[model samples]
Target: MQLKEFSFICPVIESAVVLKAIETVTSPDAIAQTLGNTDSVEERKRKLPSQLVVCLIIAMSLWSSDSMGTVLKNLVNGLSRQWTKLGQYWKVPNSLSISAARQRVGCRVMSQLFERVVRPLATEETPGAFLGELRVYYSYR
Candidate 1:
């Protein structure tokens, strides 16, 4: 039996796709207003800025099964050029940093963000989306 050649290559994601999803969902101004965050005051800083972290959180949610680092890896790999232009050097934070950033961003902000960004997929065209003016629940999972 002949062995098949395998090559590993990750597809690049356009900045517009990711940014558009975020723009539709949440904005930097909205997040800062919600979180009451001020501009960075530290003289020295690490790679994981809060704004990037927020985007990372969304990406992580989209890819729930992947480790945070893996999710970040795929996202950064896909958007390397854009990230570079933004003066961001892609470095996946350790698990501890992820935890801290989550806290720093706050659960309330994230919750409100989800409420605003995430909407019911049901529409008039979808079956039973509106049953006699009462909404239908789909996918209990």
Candidate 2:
């Protein structure tokens, strides 16, 4: 179905609010500042601002998948299809590639992205209830 034709069963938070929150937290400037004085080569890739990489990692974490293999499988069977429909970038990677990328990218980058983007976009009490609950539940588990 076209994105415009799909509707949530419940009240939905505004995408603008979520995007704005992401922008506020993950601003290029903020990322740059975080990378400052760091010797890591991964930090230099900030010049690219890889939305696909960030989205995949966040998706994996949100889905409560325990391993990169599971994450990659889910991405191929689930998220990639949606992303393709939305005209967003998505790719299926082998387990080894997924592991390599995850290791190279590291949790620090994902943590910072979550802190800056997803955290603020979360509901006032928590923004998207199901999403928030899932995140909290998965995080502790």
lDDT by residue (tens digit), candidate 1, 50-110: 6556678778776787798887676666543533234454567788887777666656667
Residue 60 error, candidate 2, Å: 1.2
**Model 2 lowest lDDT segment of ten:** 79-88
Predicted structure with the largest lDDT when compared to the true one: 1
- Candidate 2 lDDT over 80-114, as tens digits, reads 23232433354455666665665655667656655
Q: Could you tell me the lDDT of residue 78 within candidate 2?
A: 47
TM-score of each: 0.60, 0.38
Worst 10 residues of 1 by lDDT: 1-10
TM-score of 1: 0.60
lDDT scores of the candidates, listed in order: 0.60, 0.45
Clashing pairs in 1: none
Q: Which stretches of candidate 2 lie over 4 Å from their true place?
A: 1-50, 65-91, 119-141
Model 1: lDDT equals: 0.60
Q: After superposing candidate 1, which stretches have Cα over 4 Å from the reference?
A: 1-20, 37-46, 78-88, 119-128
